[model samples]
Target: MDFLPPLPLLIAFCGASVLLAVTPGPAVFYIITRSLAQGRRAGLASVAGVALGNLGNALGAALGLAALFAISSIAFTVVKYAGAAYLIYLGIKALRRPAEVRDAALGTADTRRIFRDGFLVALLNPKTAIFFAAFLPQFMSAHGSVVGQSLLLGATFVAIAALTDTIYATAAGTIAPRLRGNKRAGAAGRYVTASAFIGLGLFTALSGSSRAK
Candidate 1:
């Protein structure tokens, strides 16, 4: 299969994906919390989860489910609310947990668990599916096999996402110690994680539905 995306489109996709990856979202917040409370390894694992989840989103877009979600208000609402609820739940859980707890109760999180968390977080967001569905096709060539083009674009997206998220994890891990040593800083980190979750949930709930297909 001729899998190459058009050069310009590829560049655009890479740029957009990088921007999205770098932006602090629920995934970033979770990774930061894990890193601060546990260690670098946990944070890296969460990053892996996010990468896999993003891949799933790309797959959904390639397979046309994202388009269906975009068109169906009911389906979109269900997904949006579900995602929002999950975020809120995570936030409340984080807030209620004692500071002395280590590893974020993730049970000796390895690379697999970290990646799983990231994957589930990204995969659960219908907006990500819609994003891939709308964004990837813009760069896709009409002449090539659609599936091939999509896979290439999706892979590129995943690679960028992984790189960016890894950076976030590393940074969080590095900063975590300094923050942990200071009681006020540690408290702030916990509060920020909780706020991020609730804020993201509220944002998702209030956002107008997109009809993009």
Candidate 2:
């Protein structure tokens, strides 16, 4: 069972994962808030919860994609194109107006409750699952087992994200204090992330079409 993607695609996936991880999104903001208000311990708990939720999303995406592939190749291709369009839409929406994370009082809760909150936050966001569905297939090798490849790629991505999230959790107190107020920096980050998302969508669509031909 060939589980690993080709070396080049694996490297590309890793690079993309890093870029996505560094982008300040809902998870980042949630972790930062937990760290800022509750401390590193709380932040770490939050990170753990978010990582688990993301893992769930990845696994779900893998299974769902595999099922689609089993049902019909046409169905799978349709899903891939839909996912790409969704990514582009996300990028365009971000460009039009980046999301702002407002300061909210997350009252001091036990680490367990914070963990639960973080888990729920990530789990409930359907976008993450859609993202995994969109992004993982681009790196998959058609010759390999779809489920196996998807699982490996999904786990790899989740691991990278977890490592980056942990770093953010550890450093949030020092770095994030003034970050919320820096509109310029926030907007710049959003623009960069938006461009990356659009580029990824285009790359996926083009590569898929070329492969089809």
Candidate 3:
């Protein structure tokens, strides 16, 4: 497509996306938690939901939602704190749901709900919108349609994320069955996941606005 970046830029983008995708972050934590709790299928579903939500952010960024963040500190702060609160809320839910969790593949994973939550988790994060705004432009060329370029690059990012996220999910799923069978281990596992979520929230809260000014 004419919207696509040049070969050298594509390679650079791919490499950077891959590196970021592999890095354990909030999205990765959510996917991994789902995998260990529900199995690979749920984890993959979560990935799909997250990807869709990210696509939305990419769209929003293209439409100038990100511009608002740059211009208004209040707007950015409100969304940032809100996202952090949501993460902490989800973490609390996981912590409280230990009784529902079982050894089975699904356990209490609730793939459908997980999907929705994953979508919201990604969608609500102003930081993600900001990240894409900052991250995608590095490879863009002035010659292409700016909006088309943004969407193309955003889709590319989602594709890379889906691949790497699935890898994390599958690997976690393999160990899930064994861990879930053991009552103590399963409980412990959920707590760990819960802790990761809460930690991410706290980190996001404290770290604030990673947007490249």
Candidate 4:
């Protein structure tokens, strides 16, 4: 209980999680594409798979993160700034590049296979762990157990992502009829996500600076 983030920080984490979930990313595209191509069932399966994979990433990061922090304040500071830099870099890349969708043809009507693919896609991506390692700590209280906070917060993020991903999968047809081809919409989303990533990175960096001072 002491490890749990305060109510306001929890709310902020939830809001940030939602924004990241809604953004058109590999997992989002995977679920939506599955839904659009196969059906709602496949989409849902994919969501489940991806959720598990993301949770895996979260758990892995959380496990190592606390150990590193305990070992050295210098290591903690290094990771914090490094993560901020990575986020800023991602945002800039998203802005400069057009949004790309995962290949729809890669899946099939077999929900099991689709699920496996989804899980692998998420699990194989190293960036997911890095993002969690970077993003979750921004909201953590310095006074409590870092491991407990990381686990709780990481699970919360995965849950939020699963919910939003399910929405995307269920509404893929209606919301994104031409998601792959719609450069205009992609451009708009790009700008929004870019702004978010940049702002978050800046906030993290600035907050760390303030804490140091």
Candidate 5:
């Protein structure tokens, strides 16, 4: 009975979640690329997968597993390095790929494959887990059931993420054609994607642990 967050806190949580979701990140870029290359359905599926991954992080935070991960330096380091390596690998792969091959791969990619790819990309991201652990606890009341509050917060986060991600996917889809038609623009898109992945990799590698006592 005492598990629910206050209305104002809930509103603030929702607003913050929406804003974060809209902010460009590796996940957003992946979704945009998938949607633009494949179709709207593929994009939505990718978003759903990402939502599930985020939910997993939230659940881990709610259950205190994230705290365990945060405290264990070995585990944290493993996850962090893995994420960084993957991002770098993706960036390198993007850069090496010819435009025609990239277009072919994009065009032929299946929705389910895209969904799985997005899910894995999110699941291995230590930053996402850390963010959920740090961000959700601030809005939680000590008097409330922590688990329940965590779940509510996580759900709110996912709802906002889903809505905003969909908007990005749709907008990207709408504009993809114009870029695709222009050879120079298409080349620029590839460069941007490669740079984003590399930047994210470096950022993740250099970021300090988000654990707060």
Candidate 6:
């Protein structure tokens, strides 16, 4: 079907997605923190939630919203700013948070909270929606069904992201307990987490979403 991206385009897209996923970003930082504080299961659950949110953005982008995003600089700017603000807010919260977690493994209530927060983290970022709108269409052909093609590409991205994110979570979870005990390390961890979030936020605010040429 024309909805399927060409072999070459698909390959390129996959490669790009892998690179993007592997490169640590706000999402990665979020997953790492959750895993470090709450263990692997929480990290995985967060991954699922984030992926679902990303898929929602992809679906929205598929429904002819890409055109609006591409044509309107104002729209892009507003969303970008909003995302940055959210990230900064998250950073501030992280900074103010207690150094110690209740336990390495989260209880059901906390796990659900992590998952819900993960979903909102991705969903609230206008950058994600604009990113799907901007990035997926480049690989699509005029002859293809836009919705189908966008969904395919978006799913691919989500899958790749989930895999990479899990790897980070697992790795972080492995060492989380060590840091969990050391009070000094715990204090340091708080700053690191806060810095990561704030840095991502500032970067997002300054860097407008411009697709690769």
- Which prediction has the highest lDDT against the true structure? 3
Which tens-of-lDDT digit does each residue in 12-43 have in candidate 1? 88888778777776567767766765567878
1 versus 6: better lDDT goes to = 6
lDDT of 4 by residue, 120-201 (tens): 6566444566677778899998887887898899899889889988888888645444544555655565566567656656
Ranked by TM-score, the better of candidates 4 and 5 is: 5
Question: Per model, how many backbone clashes are there?
Answer: 9, 0, 0, 0, 0, 0
Off by over 4 Å in 2: 65-109, 174-213
Q: Which stretches of candidate 5 lie over 4 Å from their true place?
A: 36-42, 96-100, 210-213
State how far residue 115 of model 3 sits from its true place (Å).
0.5
TM-score of 6: 0.81
Work out the TM-score per prediction.
0.83, 0.62, 0.89, 0.61, 0.82, 0.81
* Weakest lDDT window of 10 consecutive positions for candidate 4: 98-107
Model 1 lDDT, residue 9, Cα: 76
Off by over 4 Å in 1: 23-26, 102-114, 209-213
**RMSD of each candidate relative to the true structure:** 3.4, 9.5, 2.5, 9.4, 3.3, 3.2
lDDT of candidates 1 onward, in order: 0.72, 0.67, 0.81, 0.67, 0.74, 0.75
lDDT of 6: 0.75
- Residue-by-residue lDDT tens digits, candidate 6, 103-177: 223333266767887787776566677778878878777888878898899989989988998899899878776
**Model 6 off-target regions past 4 Å?**
98-109, 210-213
Better structure of 2 and 3 per lDDT:
3
Task: Kindly report which residue pairs in candidate 3 clash with one another.
Answer: none
Question: What TM-score does candidate 4 get on C-alpha atoms?
Answer: 0.61
Error of 1 at 28 (Å): 3.8
